[model samples]
Target: MYRVQTSLTLLLSLATAIAGSVVHHDDSFQPDHILRVTAQNYTEACTTRYSVLVNGTSPGPELRLTEGQVSWIRVYNDMKDDNTTIHWHGLTAFTAPFSDGTPAASQWPIPAGHFFDYEVKPGIGTAGTYFYHSHVGFQAVTAKGPLIVDSNDDPPFGYHEERTIMLSDFFNETDKKIIDGLTSSPFKWSGETSAILVNGQSRQRTNSTGSCQLASICIEPGLSYRLRFIGATALSFLSLSIESHDLSIIEADGHYTKPLNTSFLQIGSGQRYSVLLKAKSEAVLKRAGKRQFYIQITTLERPKTLTNYAVLHYSSGTPADLTTVPLSPPLPTAKTVQGWLDHKLECLHPDHAFPTLNEVTRRIIIDVHQNVSDHVIWLQNGYDWVQSFPQSPYLVDIYTGRLDTGGLYQRAISQGHGFDNITRTFPARIGEVLEIVWQNRGTFTNGGLDVHPFHAHGRHFYDIGGGDGEYNATSNEERLKSSRPIQRDTSMLYRYREKTTPLAPSGWRAWRVRVTEAGVWMFHCHVLQHMVMGMQTVFIFGDRNDVMAQSDPVDAGYLTYGGSAYGNTTHSPVVRQYFD
Candidate 1:
């Protein structure tokens, strides 16, 4: 037994070496580093309390690192309350297949007052905006925080200063309460959000005097500075603007884009964007050699639904006149608008440019449709995650085949057991152009309720045509011309905007895939709640027959296997706060 353990340890060491050189200067990350976090529980006092165990007064601290470096972080759950796991969102790496932190698929939860270590190499494939949060069910309220990476890649338009804004929504309810509301009650039917929070504070008074009670970060005018924005809302996309200045959009999801000079910027949950702002100064005051311009952050979205604000404050040396930058042209609406209709027309006419076969050699279509009853629930490819409701104490075994109500399990039951169908396995071939047709069919909008921010790890895709379920040629051409740079990991699939025929088939939203890299990747909605509802699927590149690809789901029976090839055990409906 001793010899076998020694051999395994040596093998893991070699693997670590081949992956990258890891450096740990902080003693907190040491193997012996252990810390306890506590979740504050409260009720409906306008400013409600949350049921999350956090490291400090706030959530967690900012983990700063340079490019081309690897980091190892160990989180010890000292809470006397629940199990947890931290998921490094937007970071691309490979460890234990299950430890990637998708509940039911990864390892089980981290028992209260336990320990887990994450081996992370930030900015490996790409550099820019990304974040880290909890992976347990419904605990994101306590575990989410910002994971910022600066490439030392400076901007062409220089700024005097820069700051990072880690924005998140806070809930006062406990995980158990939230889960109960989501699973057993009418909350799912109504499409209600818990509450909105900026940073960890509610929109209450900020200054010392009662008159100045508000969460306000004051700034001076006449300076060009950069603001890094990371959105961590469970729902709701952020529509942001400054009351007086123009915000120059420079980056999204941590990836750079051609600078977009605009007044209003829209950011979805789990998405990030950066902007440069040149604060305006009052001309008459400047003429008298006095600074006069300042700006206030404003929102277009309803304030009560989801709270959002900005960070980073600066002042310029010389007082000068101010001006608002012209609004950037709207993003190509082809994929977001006409993509479905174009594809339908192409399917009927068989055009050369719109070829039947994609440049991608492999393809998989995911149908995120609603299996609506009077109950008003949603499903991913016909499977409802209803079984995961109520946060049971004991770890439960979930048979994926038996998950869907009318799925392969029903066939097995009718055919006297062991009869499995409809769970087809598509083995991935190297260098194939992989395509996935994501269809939204059911009762709610897009045949499904709730807007989904579709995201895929490891690759970006081209937006194809889609309509309100009916394919049209004109719609296709319009969308095709509007294709923008491939989004790194996040995109939105909104329900039809028209009021008449509300549930019209919102056609299709297609993305092209180049499987240049080989690995097991996940595609899911960035909305934490939507993901918990089973809006997730995994794609395997390379041969599925490979030993690594053939393993069963992580958390098989829901306990630590002392770490598998997929790393540690994680909980289902991956939440973003337990890691805090």
Candidate 2:
């Protein structure tokens, strides 16, 4: 028996070593394409700056690949403390549990000075503005970048050229200092945002780059350009407009939307918009017998100290004539919009389902609260996030409130226990029309509803209405009642107030959502900082297509060949299953 056992152990050890070695040398592997991250300490302007434990400097680098391409990415962790992993935002995978990156959920953390290679087979048809960030505690502080997948073969939305713009806010302060301050008091205003950056450079003052200004983009009278803009602020609801040009929005959250022509549009954090700009100015007509227009991008929330605004510079060789077009009316009501809204309401009030609802079987409420303090500042939905704790499954028949005490729930193996203090699990049925109600009880004086750009995984929904505890009476009532717009996978909770206190409704602070897909999806605040304060949640849309398919082969993406636990679950029956 002893000899047999010893032989079996040796064979297993050899196989494990072979698997690890083979994973690195596969023909599809490209370590050169790996996004090397290095999170180290530095002295910036006389203050100690810890750039979160990253593989390289400045939130890593943008990765460019093609659809259906099999690529290998290796991440090296150089920090002395804390474990880390990277999440490929919105990308689909098959053996993804090994790469899910969430500590305790998908795979184990990559220890300090160690490297982990991610075998990514880009979703067969993923081509849009997607991003990747650290899944470690507040690691997003140092890990974030554009995952650009090119596909001229079949453009989802016809466009000749495309430009990707990522917006972020910067802090010279260290992560440890911020967290210590917040934990000590947890009751003072801590929103200390000072500067904004496009890509990684803080264009507070323009250097050699000419596009820092809002009017630097130039166009020859009749050319069309596609611009993909991502709003990545930690705490700002961005209202964008052109000083004198018109923009036709063609897509939101990477999905095509009915084109809408307008001079101004709004984008909140974590949201993306693809706009088509056609230049038409009289100066171009004189030079080439046409009109030329410039594309300009500016924000509604003028930062207390603003710089590096987006601009398009256009020069007309000859005198060009520019004509102004009137704004297009809001979109008319659609069957998709009405059906989704009704389903949402019914989902929220299941016992008393909305009579108008076509399909609704579940509802969930993700209430957000702000914690204001001097040193450590942020919001906490329940508590801080802890990796060891198990989370609850997002999909459940019923929840026992007794088990949900002080942030302990069945769905979330462990609720908010980390940097963001946000929970990560919600339950729902596939195609069951789920209604999501986001309620914000302004607990802090400086607390207000920061615009949350909500996105879903496999489906989209019609936005009902978001208000400051109540509906906005002064705004367009018809637009709100008839369905503001039938947005897919993307919608913003508008900002209605600018007051320092949390009382400002900051536009529709409350939003209603109808769930229409059956898969695990994430809903989070667009503001990167707010997300750090626990403004994210997860939901699972059970395989509704397979009515008898009750047992979801636990997503292997949440595990590794080593046979260790992943999926962020620290609870019995596994709670992290929904988010990981």
Candidate 3:
């Protein structure tokens, strides 16, 4: 039997539908979290602002889960006014499953003073770096925290210790104020980040480092530590480094990758990595004459960059000042300077994964660019996504026989085939492999080539890599035969310095997804700023009739707000039983 193991979490018994397929760590799973969401006013970086904090704190609290068994997270929106919903960043459960938590697409925002329980099952393969965050508006900037899932078996790699590094960008203003400026009629852009933070604190800008508020981690002189780096920044792409040490990467987005050693690395929002760092020996420390090293972070590729620091402290034999700063190290070479996020990352455990990056049944091409219009708006295949909150959440509409196909159709262009949407949705039948291509045209207004970190809510794709030109399937056919690309929940679509029109791509990235889950899922740029201007869309697996016919009964809890009431439906996916 599944039981809750934590004060804030509880669990229910696994359903009978797919009982035997579940993976158990100790022959059972536990904990269904009740995360409380609230907006708290706090002072930071010499400014006062209110932020959407979970359980009354920024970056919230970490929730741990075991692989397999169904779990529940009852999100209580404790705020006096604002609505909120938490999206589990990465898990076995692709974002396609119900309660994956994207406001209006998967379901409605959990209303203020009310609560919603997200019931999901994390299957066998989902045992690595995942996080929870508010997906509504720009709330993720502050309302986010780590979500750890333990592997049933020992991890492929070994470490003496482990810790987390949450890298985030800070805005002094509130979420509403920032979003309003970007979405304004004349387009008042929200400027660069007020400050960059490592674990929610940073050093003060002064000649003296006496008042540094940086986060610190204590380490033994000679021990191997696994650092799980989370990219929680909303706007900036960043470079991270530590003084006199190397970071050997073991995992990316929850999958073990071939170890790639680097002095430093770049991280974009919504991305995650697990790196192994071996601490310096006592002899090396004695020669160097330092027990503290700074974990440095700086914004990448921007004219005016932001920077921050955290401390990697060596535990003293006795009580001592661990806060004493160490000498700074020289910056490492930016990998993008060579082009791409190190496609050298092949799957470390291919035998345990799906087949290598390969053949697909259909290709959907999406061109991204800022529109030439009276107001500032971004376009995906000439369609402007002007709605943030739909009257009917897509999943509810589909279940209640109120699914709207009005203005949704196949969009054929010179580039390729995709979907055109007023409601921003398209359907794909089960058992079909789909290739999604992102062609970044940037903007006609500015020559700025923005690197969009694209993220799909319900689907993790077989990544086909990215580069500074148009995607050519014809040329890459033979290349796929020998490569097993590492999977990514969030991957970057590049943009180059080259001159090109929206129809003429400056850069591109591609991914292959096999339709397995039946639900409405979100697809978009992980950069919240880009999504604010409509750089997003939706995907629905299985035809409407097939979905409605085989769907289980809907809970009365879901049908209350924006969720439509269905005459009859079940919570389980009876439709999936037909799969091989």
Candidate 4:
């Protein structure tokens, strides 16, 4: 036994070395690092709370890699009680589906005290601002960071400096308590955000006297900066604007687009935008002497307005405390924010080139709704996905065909199972262009429409169009024929409100993706709570033979515990049958 363990360890080490050595492009750089997940006590929102973190930081460390480079990231889970997995948000795992970091979909959660290695080569055309976060439970609300790929191809625009602005919402309660409340019988929603963070830090007012520190971004006059805006919040959708500055958006979810200038920007959870900010001219700064601007983030919902503030400091001048930053132009009212939303609704990502699809091979319409039985549960197409445990994960089961004859698989195809036991899987052949229309039907109780940011795991899709109302095929055909669309991995399904009546038509978003990769890819709402309640499904592309033949040995070695070349396990009868 001891000898076998030693041999496995050596094989893993050699595999890691080889993975770190592979290069695809001349400008590619191999970025290899290890992140340890541990429980840490940190203070936020004027309170100290116990939370799970990566490398001792809430936002973790920024992972920088050049385009066309292979990345090897080893994550060691040292949390005292919980298993963890990190999902690279907006990244298409491509050939490495097992490394996609979705528990029960790509691979099982890494048991506490164990580690997993994620290896992926970001080939050409994968450059942009992205992020990584915990995919299990409420951990992602605090455990997340930036994943940036520098482009080998020079960009059309020029910038003197760059900054990554990560935004998140903070709650005073622990993750466990929050999860318990959200999933409880009565179905209590997490109340308004206690605080908002800019790059994981913000001034939390303890009392009327105001006791806390603010995060400041220093800037110099006469310089252009590329600000990478990442919306990492768990629940909040933010409407943000820098005082006296107009933002020119150049990139969305890692894809460069034509510059679109806007006074304010709306960023949904799990989405990213890269905007170019030309600093105030030196002449203007010298005339004003000392000045500072407030970078404000406000919630887009109504009833009670919540806002968070960060400081944009000019290095040449000093300003008063954060509280005293003059409110020359008062924070935007909800009405003003609504106006901006209406104006920018038609062209959210206006600059992306449209795809030339001879025809959409498949069209699937999915409806998002909520049902209350034992608890309030979110549903996709009338099905709630609950991860089955103790059994092999979905990928292993599908790849091995163990579940092919099982009742679950049969029901999945026929759509004959109850909502609680339904496993939604849409099958597609290789190279087929799929058009998915995501329809959002608001909750039943309040009839209040919520904006859901939907994300796909294995590929970026071309966002053809979106509108508020029931999806009409004839009308959609006309719209798609006239407009060119942008490519993105995550997009917001906008909600519209009725002016006179309380009931509004549902909103629908359409995107087209070509199924080039052969694997099980997940598509779901990026809102953590909604996902936890069950708003997700999978797209199984191609046949099992195609996927298994292309599986990376190193990745399979990790999944099967370095046992054998084929990585068969006894728990999964299907895997055992195929490999043994």
Best by TM-score: 3
lDDT of 1 by residue, 1-580 (tens): 0001123432343333222222322333343222245566533214546666456544466666555664546666666767677776766533333335544433455556455555455544355666667767666655777667767566545787666665555555556766666555455421444434445543322222222112333355555777777777666655555544577777667566666676655666776777887755546335655343222222222224433233222335643222221133122111223222222211111223222232544345555665444344555545544214313211121223222323432453344321223432122333455445665554554333345667765445544644455444445546566443334456656555422233345545566565433344557777766666556555444332221223333233324322221122252121111111
Candidate 3 local lDDT, 237-289, one digit each (tens): 88888878889988888888888887787787888999999999999999999
Error of 3 at 291 (Å): 0.9
Q: What TM-score does candidate 2 get on C-alpha atoms? A: 0.64
Global Cα RMSD, each model: 10.4, 12.2, 7.9, 8.9
Model 3 CA deviation exceeding 4 Å by range: 1-31, 92-97, 207-212, 317-329, 332-335, 351-358, 372-374, 386-389, 404-416, 498-503, 545-551, 562-580
Q: What is the model-wide C-alpha lDDT for candidate 4? A: 0.69
Worst 10 residues of 1 by lDDT: 571-580
Q: 1 or 2: which has the higher lDDT? A: 1
The Cα local distance difference test for each model comes to 0.48, 0.47, 0.69, 0.69
- The Cα RMSD in angstroms, rounded to one decimal, for candidate 2 relative to the true structure is 12.2
| Residue 311 of model 4, lDDT score | 82
Evaluate residue 170 in candidate 3 and report its C-alpha lDDT on the 0 to 100 scale.
Answer: 80
Q: Give the clashing residue pairs of candidate 4, or none.
A: 128-254
Give the TM-score ranking, best first. 3, 4, 1, 2
